[model samples]
Target: MITRHFIDVPRTDGSARRVHYRRCGQGQPLLMIHQSPRSSAEYAAVMQAWGAHFTCIAPDTPGFGQSEPLAGTPDINDFADALIDLMDALGLERCPAYGFHSGGIILVTALKRHPQRFTGMAVGGYAIWTPAEMAIFGESYLPPFQPSAYGEHLTWLWNRMLEQSWFFPWFDVRGEARLPGAHADVARVDQAVREMLESGDAYRAGYGAVLRAPRDIPAADAVVPPVLISAYFGDPLQAHIDRLGPLPAGWQAQKVDTPADHHQASLDWLLALPPVPAAGLVETPHEGFAHVVSAGFDGLVHWRGAVGETATVPAPGGAISLITGAGIDPPGHGLSDDWPAAAPTDRTVWDAVFAEVQRLRGFAGFDFEPITAGDPHHLYPDLTPDRFGSHLTRAWSVVRAGAFFRPRHQPSAANAIAFDSTAIAPDRLAAKHLALLQARSARAYHAAYGRTDGP
Candidate 1:
């Protein structure tokens, strides 16, 4: 089965980048890089197809999916560095790779900078734009992706994704550049839209870097790893093949008729090469982190500092390992990646998180009672409808803000000291929690559906 995982990798600057990836099959590693505005989720279908032959590791490139983006306006090479950092952290000395579009750009950059790190590469549609074309796209292809309080951006986003297939430069409709493949598929559009939502403004940062990046086509004299560049007929950049005048010794370019043909060609090329064993996942000894196969969520669930090592929470038949804290990316905290758009409720999320904890740690049940700042109970009441607002408020807040960065439902005990808990007496904590929750609800309302009135 295809499995999801997260590994904390420190960049060259010493900041940690929690890289999230999907892995399956077993053999030599084949690192898969995805195009921007999408996650490694793009390779879900392809991973299964190629998993039997190779241990396919596809990561949500920084700032796109679960993995965090680079700090500030980073260069495209920074992304290449992130890839190297991930490889080093995962213990992958050298591996073959396949990249598509912007993914191809990233891998090519990495290959140029460090040729010994990769055995070979098979890339689909590497963009080779002229100076003027680069300028046009760099300025307008991707805009600032921040969320508007009224969600006015949604209108543009939906249309932009849908119309992208119809037009080369989506903004241009000058008749000559209209694409024959331009058509709408709800499922396809929805998938991209949800990813874009998870990405938010970070899309511009990642994608913009690609547009601004300089290409380094290997010289014929330079000894480099083999590379295959394939562009399907319908691909927008198919013509760029001619633009690539000369290639290195082992480099070859092909113009394929269809995506399936292109994919098969790439697959065959990879299988033809020698396999290099990838770094396997390390086992957690006692109290640490592990990627558990949860029904809905797939990422790391940490069991450090939750409870004692030998201690088990009382349960029905046996006992459950105490596991707490959400994952560390968008939506929640600990180490999970992006939250889905359909979006589950607080109860469902906790239940799913804990269930994975129980199953992975070989426990029958769990006794997880988190008393933290953003605990769902603060927004949602179990029995009596408490003064705190409904869970919908927080969910909507997260949806609108494009993230739940600072969940304002309930403050920790330290905050009580911060807000003068003793002076306000008995009702102080309760009042403060309710006030914060309601205030957050109003902001969510404004951001989600443009409701400006305070709760």
Candidate 2:
């Protein structure tokens, strides 16, 4: 089974840094580096496939996911050193490394400086940028992705990732370098958007470093570990193979027709080699903390939830999603990081959040009601009494503990309650959701019609 974890690495500045990683299988230790603005979550499927043959460790590169970002605007070498630090912390002396896109840049640079640390390497889409290309990317690619009042940045991010294949660099206007792989799958785009939100503007730090870093392809007779570079036809970097002149004696480059073929080829190449038996990194259970742009809020949410999707509790009448001022489907309650520090206290803000959620889920007909999150235990960073003390808080606690004091009468199974992963833990904190929703729904019903009778 694939397990998720975090390890505390000692930083050069004498500060402890947390690096999050996903691990599975029990063969050789193979370090997997994912592209920037993405986390170890990207390699879950890859780990599942490759785990039987090798111990896969995919980290959420610095500044992305739950892993801590660098102290400042670090360059490629800093990023590479951070990775090497991760290796050292894990006690991996020498092992093959695999990287993708931006990850390829870090691995290549790391291998160059410390060739003795790796046995073999497989890279997908190693970028060899021209000055003009770099200039273009530097100007438009890694823009600061901060949250806006109306969630405008989200619109840009979704389009940016979706249109990346439509136009090679995504921001290009002339339709040059158009890719055949452009897609519009909401779920696919949603995942990347959530990761980017976790990264916030820090993506500029990690991703920009790779794009601006110098590239040095090893010479034909250069003494280094075996390396294989491959890119699928649809990947823009496939064209860069020609840019690499005079590969080293142990280097091999190939252009595959598809990503699956590319992945399979890389796997075959690695499996043919002898195993790398290295001790696994010390593991710590994930604390279920991550960030996402959800409900018009850009900030920390707890207990592992994805953006733009809630559990699809199918009710023939459709779902009625419960959102609150605070609590895990949290909006107010002091947990959400809002730049303007807006609260959903106003009906207008709740309406705007509902609209944004609709856009994210990419569907309509679902209903929404804003409830008061009176339960203090449901909040994180712990809401202070001075800030949130009120009748609602005290009253909600009574409603939660008292089973008979349900707010809404028993709605038919035809009506399933839904809440964003942040507002409520999908499974662990589900009971709180039930009590909170029942009370709030019943209260709304009681207010509307002086009666709490069952349907």
Candidate 3:
């Protein structure tokens, strides 16, 4: 069942702020924080699915939805405090949460100061900014709210909204903008606008709060909790994605095609992750990529491809590998090699994996320096051929089983035993191996190097 209601939550600054909340299902609590220019209403569909497994609670922060704005309107830190207050008001000791854009920044604040208050977090489109990137975002972040009496504000708002819809890297307006045809679902767009209009001051407060808020989330990576990042196309949060770089320890970022898809993807991710154990040894990878299934690891799921390509799957148990395009020389002459040191510093496991496959296919290697970036576990299937085969299979087993191995010391369980093929004993091992290889073979290929076109 789903229920929506309004409750007053106290702010850190001694004011009562109104909070609009939607509750559904009954289980471990899951809180969702909405992005700016959006309210909790955006999560309606998502809460329904997530409610099946969790007691979903989505709240409009102080300045959004039915919520009253903070009196003095403090920064994001103050907003974070209000969210925490909402949790306390509801008698929640701890909760898991999902946030996007500005909301992600707010949660990062909560995680940093009140780590124990959260069970886990799923952050979508976290904006980590480079100096130049921040400069660009600063320009786009807040276009004059109520444009000076001239219709200039309205024009900018209309074009900005429409143009932002296009894929990012908005370079030239060489082409005209594209909006859904008349036959398209006008209702959704109307609904979005209606919410914006009805909110009145809520809109101003929220947008203004966002504008005045600090451009960066302090100690973002240091916030300790199982974090999953879902970044989609046209996501204004790309700056956050870029700033994350290889991602900090215990954090993972996945790239998706759009924001709407993140709810389900994030839910699946949260459900798949096991919570942290209180005592028993907790294993974490020191180096290299390993498929992880825990709240602590980031889910690097990505959605990328041209139309009409094969659908990709998440690597089983969250394992990843080095996959590269074909035509690269094998581990010598600047080509991919078997050992790590043999590979160039620029090359990543993805390139190394790609090089390995190409070597198997008898392709000539090229002098390509690898650009290794830790893709969220979710992106593994799209980028790696074997997804969860032997190469990744060995790595995943170790991480899950929590057994430390020689040559590398970390708490990783061994799934290699389960993955091994005996050809044929009492167990149709050869058949199992054949099936595994076949699935992987479908993904192993050499395509245009460096560009994320598709399979």
- For residues 1-455, could you state the per-residue lDDT of candidate 1 as single tens digits? 66776677866676666667888778888999999889988898999999889999998998987678889999988989889988888888999999999999999999999899999999999888988887778678887765444345556776788888888888777797788787677667756765786677888888988888886578877799999999988798899999887899989999999999999999999988777875687322333445655546655544432332222321110112112332211122322332333334444554565555655555443332222233344333332221221332333343322122223343344333232324234232222222232231221212222211211
Q: How accurate is candidate 3 locally (lDDT)?
A: 0.49
Return the TM-score for each candidate structure.
Answer: 0.70, 0.66, 0.51
Candidate 1 accuracy as TM-score: 0.70
Best by TM-score: 1
| Model 1 ranges off by over 4 Å | 282-356, 359-455
Query: How large an RMSD does model 1 have?
Result: 10.4
User: Which candidate tops lDDT?
Assistant: 1
Per-residue lDDT of 243 in model 1 = 84
TM-score ranking, high to low: 1, 2, 3
Worst 10 residues of 1 by lDDT: 313-322
Point out the higher-scoring one by TM-score: 1 or 3. 1
Q: Which residue pairs come into collision in candidate 1?
A: 320-365, 326-334, 327-333, 327-334, 327-335, 327-336, 328-333, 328-334, 328-335
Off by over 4 Å in 3: 11-15, 136-140, 143-160, 167-185, 201-205, 208-223, 234-240, 257-261, 272-455
Worst 10 residues of 3 by lDDT: 279-288
Question: Residue 260 CA error for candidate 2 (Å)?
Answer: 1.2
The true-versus-predicted C-alpha distance at residue 249 of model 3, in Å, is 3.2
- Our model 2 lands, by Cα RMSD against the true structure, at 15.0
Record all residue pairs in model 2 with backbone atoms less than 3 Å apart, i.e. clashing: 325-332, 328-422, 328-423, 329-423, 329-424, 330-423, 407-439, 407-442, 408-442
